[model samples]
Target chain A: MDVDIDKIPKHLLRFEYPIFEFNKAIIDATHQYVVAYKPNMAFYEANGLKGWKSLEKTIKYLNKNYPEVFTIADAKRGDIGNTSSMYAKAFLKDLDFDSITVAPYMGKDSVEPFLNFEDKFTILLALTSNEGAFDFQTLSTQDSPLYKKVLETSKTWNYAHRLMYVVGATKAEYFKEIRSIVPNNFLLVPGVGAQGGSLQEVCKYGLNKDIGLLINSSRGIIYASSESDFSEKAAVEAKKLQLEMKQILENHF
Target chain B: MDVDIDKIPKHLLRFEYPIFEFNKAIIDATHQYVVAYKPNMAFYEANGLKGWKSLEKTIKYLNKNYPEVFTIADAKRGDIGNTSSMYAKAFLKDLDFDSITVAPYMGKDSVEPFLNFEDKFTILLALTSNEGAFDFQTLSTQDSPLYKKVLETSKTWNYAHRLMYVVGATKAEYFKEIRSIVPNNFLLVPGVGAQGGSLQEVCKYGLNKDIGLLINSSRGIIYASSESDFSEKAAVEAKKLQLEMKQILENHF
Candidate 1:
């Protein structure tokens, strides 16, 4: 589940309820069905310091209430060595996210720092769902596309076992090529519903023995309805995805 | 001037002074010689909410006192369309930075949102100063290296005029090649002093009609001393770089 704070309904925002309140409502409605709750850091950050405070509150609420539910900070952050170390501390240690989405633009040093934290995952951007994914990610090198090189090179980093890759559901066909590169690593697949990607198509080529795929649908699930019964409407959408996931798991495993 | 807050004197941290105090002293000492002061977001973010508050205070101080100093939030942040828009608002609107660094891996949508803001610059990561830069940035394609493609493709985006590229000082030899691709655009060059990159080499190929380069030296200037007179020591180091920049301008322009 992806929680974009700004996209929450006007009814909630008009009442001046804290952003965390809306998040809490969503968590209450969906935690039982969710394996992880990925919050896009940019959305919280856009609102300034108060938004950050809301994020802190939301994370604390999750830890206290649903400790089993994984939290991914969808912050595509990477920098040089020392700077990357600081970002690792920010998201992993301070905010205590299970993992973070990182851009693989800067190579090993930028990534290795995040991998240093034991048990915390570093979800590197392999092939994103955005139209810009075509810009540089798919550029053909002598050996392979740039995204494949990212996967192959990052596998050599320290704590390579803790690494996962972001492979968009939009490009489900690419999963066959992607899986061939890193067969065992889990794939966080976004763009499933609203982006017009099929869950069945993603599972066909991307699934491994470990059932290594996290299919995400943000707008489709969250904005299913804008009425006062938003949480209940959200629950219906969540249940639908959960059922689809369950069926995929049973058949494949 | 790049302020790595944690690198401030042990006495300051020991006394539990807010990080802004250290930044204020640094700014007071070096603002005259400095064309800009960049605070790496990761450093402030590592300390959590209080750190973000200090970041706000630091930027406010720079804007109010040293209005001439261009402030770059050394935040290499980018995401999808809506998410990228949020990040644009976070740095360009909410925090009100003159510019923020963006990783171009996700392509146009990730970068274009920041460009939408008038008078604000989007410093795209073209070729960074880290060893990991060798991993993908320098990878050759049919036409050119990936970094050159980024420069060429990003030039076609909306508000491309507001864009600046990060061409590392460590690879001063690549400057001539880089300048040929984007002759008019400014390059924000890091890695000059502490990273052993020569300013003269960077200037030899990078200087344009506008003297278009912002060469950065963080550790070399800020960590010149750890004693009570640390800020004074920083001023002397900054003055050396300022003098060097003056000479380069006079000789080249």
Candidate 2:
């Protein structure tokens, strides 16, 4: 689940507390139903240093309370080799995220440093849920689509085992073709609820032997209601997805 | 110039001081020979909250002491519509950067929020100087290259006047083709000096009526020496580039 802090509902904001308070409520309510907590860095960063403090607190809260839940920094960060190393340290080392989202635009050297970390994962943006995914991701060469090229080329890099790719749930039809290219790797699927993607349709083509999928629902679960029952509403929304996921696991396994 | 803070020499590191102290000396030494200072955010963020504090201090130092010099937050950030708006605030509003480098992979909504700011510039990644540039940037359709498509499509976005493009110094030959597409916009050219790109070649094909180029040399200038004379050495390097730029301006103008 991606926690976009700014999108917290009005009832939650009425407490006149820091953003972490809202995050705490959400985590307390929904942690049982989630395998991971993914927080997009931009939302916290937008508020400046104060925002970062909240992010640090939120991550600490997750680690201290729910040690079993994996934490992801959905920063979408990548640069050159040395620079990428710095980002790797920032998220994987300093912030203690299990994984960080990266853009594949810069290629091999840009991503290599992130993979160098021992146990940490690097999730490359394969096919995003937004309209912009059509811009360069779907563009074709003489051989294959650009997204396919990303998968093929990245597999050749060092520490390829730590690699995962993001495939939007909205692009469920492409999952069959995507699975043909990367059959073993996990796919972090976004856009299931708010973006109108069907969980059932995504699972039909995306599942692998490892039951590889981390379906994220941000706005749908985190911003479920604007009233005082926001956390309860969020829990209900997450439970619905969790139950669906449990059913899918049983069917596939 | 993109200041990758970790690249500062061993001599400067001997001080056992905060990173901003080294940056202060570098800026004091080289400010006269430069028009702008671009700090790559990953370098600072990698060190965690303390590193970000150094970044905040560095930017404040530049703005306080040298108001004439433009500052670019070379953080290649972009996301969906609402998320991008947060990044715009993080860099342009909270951090007070004069400009920011953005990735065009997400298309309009991801970039439009950055451009929405008045008087701030948004430099889109068109052609980067790294090996990863070949991964997706060069993929061509029947009409033009993906980078070209980015230039054409982004030109139609809101606040297009605030836009610029990153044309790597390594791809001097492509500048001719790129300039034809975006003739008037400034190009932030990296890969000069230490990256083995010829400043002369880039200016030959990239310059416009405004001498529209910000040729960046990061390692070549900042890590010019590993002794106490580091600041003076950096000044010498920056002066050399400035003189060459002046000669290029004289010949072209």
Complex DockQ per candidate:
0.89, 0.69
Give the CA lDDT, 0 to 100, for residue B154 in model 2: 86
Point out the worst 10-residue segment of candidate 1 chain B by lDDT: B1-10
Indicate which candidate wins on TM-score.
1
- In candidate 1, residue B13 scores what lDDT? 75
Residues B1-253 of candidate 1 have per-residue lDDT tens digits of 3445556777787544358888888889998998888899888878778788888888988888888889999999988888888889889888889999999999998899999999999999999999999999999877889999999999999999999999999999999989998999999999998788999999999999998999898888878997789899999999999999999898876
Displacement of residue B9 (Cα, Å) in model 1 is 2.3
User: What's the residue-level lDDT of A129 in candidate 2?
Assistant: 87
Q: Number of clashes in model 1? A: 0
Off by over 4 Å in 2: A1-17, B1-17
Task: Report chain B TM per candidate.
Answer: 0.96, 0.95
Query: For model 1, what is the C-alpha lDDT against the true structure?
Result: 0.88
